[model samples]
Target: MAGCFDVMQHNASFDWDTRRNTYSAIFAGFLFFFAWWLVIDTAVVFTPTGDWNNWYFALAVSCSLSMFMVNSVSNRALEGLYSEEGVLGVKGTRIWLMFGFIGSFACIIAGIWIMFGDYVLQKNDNPKWPGVAIFLHTLLTFIASLTYKFGRSEELWD
Candidate 1:
């Protein structure tokens, strides 16, 4: 009950670190959950013949991989605070981060391709929900990863 009032207040401010972190985490979690829910529900509810293949899950899978690549290194490490001790140096972190961004963008491009090449351009009796779900999965997961990675202030934590 007390927690409900705390979350219900519209006058919340980022000045409160715990509040900011809580809100960001909640928002990111909601987006991720909703995205997966939509994709899975669409896949199950609108299963067409021979068209609903494994390729539809590529977007979500790639997004998860990208998130791992991007966030596996801590912000302190990226900032060169622990350059000498880690197996992956600052340069390696940068390289991984770069590839993560690349993979993230690639998945989005693939989503677009699935939406157009598979569903839009294909002249079949298949439902278009798969394509749309794939695209939304990529987009929402990317956004959620960004939110979880950047929205919190880890600099304050030890």
Candidate 2:
């Protein structure tokens, strides 16, 4: 909310510019959508199930909706860092990141456990094709976003 930031800034006696404020909100919206594109949309490729498990797509759509919520909360937070107002904090944004981080990890862990499961079941002759490698690769893309910035913001200068 603008008031939240306004209250904080006013209490600190810092002058906030309306132009910068406008830009920050706009930038937050941009990053929220971009992050969805990079992370959630990528996840969708893995879920082609015809049923409701189409959640990967739902997640992507929800991430887009949250863009507005994130802007309403205040935009600057989403522009640069991973703090509260950041794109990462928006409900959908946070969910997608979690899905990518935890969901991907769960898939990887399951794949590994399956390998052991197969071994114990005396199916050792079976190839180690649990699909773990693919899951890991997807998760790594998310991690890569941390080191590599991929969105544009008015605050960012070349």
Candidate 3:
């Protein structure tokens, strides 16, 4: 069984990082739309709470914060991997990759909140299972993205 698993394993490489970056950017865009859907649903459900415009504002703020975090992380990663000349050439592009991961995380979180809050208030929902599902999905997706370059390599804590 271990041998079978080893046969299918992948390893870290620059090529792998490049592929991951493409996928990351695509997913990030998906997250932006996902957040939009959630906010719209929330406002529609809770129109009595106030005007619908505020929910869009919340979504915008969350995405903006996420982009800031993404840029910060990407900047560090680029600095570590490239020389100053390389960094100058690529830094602007790297920011997009960071934006993807951060945006995905933010959208997933907001989606959970919007979907569950109204469910609980209007449908007498119990959120224990749904909450766990949301958490695990978010965590697993994040870990998967972060480790895409490492492939099958396992990291152990000392």
Candidate 4:
């Protein structure tokens, strides 16, 4: 058991100049775990005893997944902005970055829209956990992506 633990620690000890990647990865993992738990808890374990169908679970899952995908794509697209040379040239790189920014904002807006339209409007008297979870997931996804993108900066105040 000690040998196994030593091997695991050795494998995990990689040189990282900054803590952004580690922090972002941790945050993303936590967000995903929380989302999974929330869905399982609400949809399966603690479900209200009825024949009712709660669509919020599906919506929350979809929104969280979409936010993650959008963040990933945007992060990849941002690579072009930092490259010294690209096949598509500087203009194309700028375009890619612009599109990525737009997509990120669009995902955020969509999350807000779903929260307001599905939860706030429908359950005005009693707001539920699903909407809040989706919103928090979206925000976390955005922060994680930004952290990954800007984490490599050599600036004094990063």
| Residue lDDT tens for model 4, 39-153 | 5564563346431236555555555554444444333344544445546565665565566656656666766876676567783455456556556655665665565555544
Better of 1 and 3 by lDDT: 1
lDDT accuracy of residue 38 in candidate 2: 51
Question: Between candidates 2 and 3, which one is better according to TM-score?
Answer: 3
In model 1, the runs with Cα more than 4 Å from the true position are 1-16
Best by TM-score: 1
Better of 3 and 4 by lDDT: 4
Total clashes for model 1: 0
Error of 3 at 114 (Å): 9.0
By summed lDDT, the worst window of 10 consecutive residues in model 2 runs over 144-153
The order of the candidates by TM-score, greatest first, is 1, 4, 3, 2
Off by over 4 Å in 2: 1-92, 119-124, 129-158
Candidate 2 residues 57-110, lDDT tens each?
343343333333322332243333544554446665545544544543454454
Higher-lDDT candidate among 2 and 4?
4
Question: What tens-digit string does per-residue lDDT give for candidate 1 at 45-148?
Answer: 76655556765776787787897787676788788887375887888888889999899899889888888888877786777877888888889988988987
Report, for every candidate in turn, its global Cα lDDT versus the true structure. 0.80, 0.40, 0.49, 0.55
Q: Give the TM-score of candidate 2.
A: 0.29
Per-residue lDDT of 141 in model 1: 83
Q: Quick one: how many clashes does candidate 2 have?
A: 3
- Model 4 regions lying over 4 Å from their true place: 1-84, 123-127, 154-158
TM per candidate:
0.82, 0.29, 0.36, 0.53
